[model samples]
Target: MARSYSSYIVAQSKRTPCLQNVCQFISDDCRKHDCKIVSLEFFAQDEKPRRTDLDQLNLEALLNTDVCGCQGRLIIVEDLSTAVIETLGSCLDIDPLFFASQIHGPTFDIVSSKPSDAILPSRALSQNFLSVQYQRTVDFGACSSAPRKMLRNSNVPRKIVLLPPIKNRSIGLEQQSCSILLSTTKSKPWLGLILVDKPNSDKYTTSEKQLVLPSTPFQGGYEDFSERPCFFEPDSGSPGRVSLLEDLVYYWEKERPPAFQPDQPTLLSLTYYPLKIAAAEWVSYVAVISHSIKQFEYSTEATFEEHGLRKIDSDLRSLEVWGRRCLQTSSKLQSAISFLKYQINGAPELEEYSLMIRDFEYIADLVTTYGRRLEIMVPVVTSVLQITDTRRSLKEAANVTRLTYLALLFVPLSFVASLFSMNGGVSAHDLTIYFAVALPLCAMVFFVTRLPTFDFVPLGPAFGKFGNWMRKAL
Candidate 1:
């Protein structure tokens, strides 16, 4: 017995008339070719079926007459060509070259030439269609061969070639889309291959333009290319494409040389790597350089006290000269000291390394002036104390001299008064006057002996302890 096979064309459509007409045309064509006409299933608008689960349904049996013995083939004919394209593109298992040959007209030649890997179901093809069934598996080899033959015949100004994505282990082609966009809209018509993985899954959509470089002939090899992954957003526009040539140029300019140049062997191997990787390494190198500069600045700032002191001392000399001029007047000396104190206590600006050095120099100047003055002032203070002691001694000596002079003047007077009182005439009254004068003279002697001598002491341990205690209290 001869084996019987069946073919089924599964399609979805909103427009009933167009769906019915297309189904009838396909059924008539199958019969003319000596194939048995199974059943024509018209899924009306009310019978809108979901396409997602269409593969699992008894679509083959519903359209085929002899189910058990039939070898089945499914050909989807839809009014929405774009939607049909997109739906088929998303089904990874479905080979698009098998059905793309059914599209009518010269456009079929160009469409057929496109790599089967590039075929993507378009959103427009999802709207409306019909389904047909037959008893044999569809042969797509003839359809696959037509695309390459078409490319050979056409002298189109721009050519778009789509190649599969690179795989780590396999040499076989991966799914991809390629199209050429003409720079001059009039020169060569734009060609597009829309690829869809799923309604919402990853879709590969791309556009390319041809360029003629001054150094190269137009007939040479196609160099300029751009590609992008496309997705449908509810209201958003299409996806953008990145040019491979442009990407290469950008990475080439951005990449930096290694800090330490490697040996020739390593350098030659590095040249084979992608420019993006090289650029990343260059960025990392620059970051390290910047960090090192900061570290050096910090180290220098930390050692500013040692290296920066000389500059500070020079400024200090000027401050000391000013201090000396002001010191002659006590009030100005106090004002100068207050200013120096204020400067030391206030915060300094050291944001930049150079600024920190400048500030250190300023500080050095102030310290130099203050340091020198402190040294000179300490000895001067000692000398002044000695002079004060000498002055106190001289004052005490003068007081004693005065007391001696007073004693000389009053003793004779007192004696004379007593002598007078001793005389026989008016003796009682004279004695009373002599006693009053003698009493005042003794009081004066007592006061002169006690007052000035109280504070005089030798500079020894006791005096040193007393001085320290005084300082602490102050």
Candidate 2:
């Protein structure tokens, strides 16, 4: 369900009607040129997941959605659409056909050896979107088809670009909104959005367009795609909310030390949104992994030896996934950092960009290194567990062997006593005979058991000499 966030921030009018009513209310003064912000949170697994989980990517469906302002009024479409897609080779290991099928569903029919997994007019869009394979040697082409029935689940598609036409009789005609982004965390490395409407020459075009209207969160049911499970989630609409306006509102009200310029908001929304998203990603990951490390180490300790091995197994796997995430994330952040290069505007913003890039770049590396080291401990911990099992087994076997030897010592005495008792009646003389018989057997058994040397090497030289002498005597 979409709710208006216009109240959260300072806006001219707070009339947040359903998104369906956009056409009837488009002409409203507050609706026109009013900044609309929509934030969609993304969630993805570390590996290629089953179709049921992701269904169709969120962005792809959004781009393909029939967005109309009125009942059937001509919605403006962007003249040009630009998208930057990033992916890791490890994530997209399937062939282009299979990948496309997974993303576009069974209806997704883009059969090619090269990775063009996107549903776009040009093959280059798919090719560019297949940047994951680009990281490694070119390989992931097509794989066997996995058929899925016509599924219209509640799953939200990847990137949703709503480019409705701006109708103004005063201006030339109607101008369209363009620049579409269709990607997922697995298919794309970095997770952020850039939505800006520039003044396109012609009629109905204006520079006051903000991408997402309705003040609503334009996200579907991504119950799974959540931030890394952290110690605690920052308050919503808080500075930690990862939105430019939220922070600006807090800054304007709370921290009003220096004269804050108006452009800072634009700089943040346009350029630094990605950085904020990326930074949040890093923070969430770091918090989760650090907690896991402690939990893992604690579980594997001697005190918790019952399921120690299993605990290590889980924690180590987590570490490995985290490392892969870091490796993939670093590249995506680099692209973002590079993109931030173009976003530099004034002196103050430039300095902010430099500091952010420097600090985040270090954090990106720090995450990678920390995760790799943690992952390496998997094998070591595994070996320790094996040794612990082997040692326990050996000790048990030794105890069993000692018990067997002790039992052997009493077997002969038990047998002799049973034989004597088998006689129905025994006189004193018979008892004396039984005792005598049993006594010699017990003495012989004891003597053998106590022998210092069971085997004595005969005089080998005497045997050889005797054989020679015997031959002559015979």
Residue range 1-474, candidate 2, lDDT tens digits:
543322121121222211211121222323222232333222232111111111113434432343322111111111112110111112222122222221221122233211222223343323222221101000111212211111111111122211111121010111111122222334222222332232221121113432211112111101121234455865333342323333323333332222222212232333333244345445544543454455444334332355755655655565565566557556555654554454443456367567766766776677676667677767776666677677667778999988865775576668777887898888998878877887687666655444333233374565545545543442
Question: What overall lDDT, based on C-alpha atoms, would model 1 receive against the true structure?
Answer: 0.28
Q: Candidate 1: misplaced stretches above 4 Å?
A: 1-351, 427-474
**Which number leads on TM-score?**
2
Question: RMSD, each candidate, Å?
Answer: 37.5, 20.8
- Model 1: which ten-residue window has the lowest total lDDT? 130-139
User: TM-score of every model?
Assistant: 0.18, 0.42
Candidate 1 lDDT over 37-110, as tens digits, reads 11112122222211211221333333223333222212222122332333333432232233332322222243
| Model 2 residue 331 distance off true place after TM-score fit, in angstroms | 3.7
Query: Which is the leading candidate under lDDT?
Result: 2
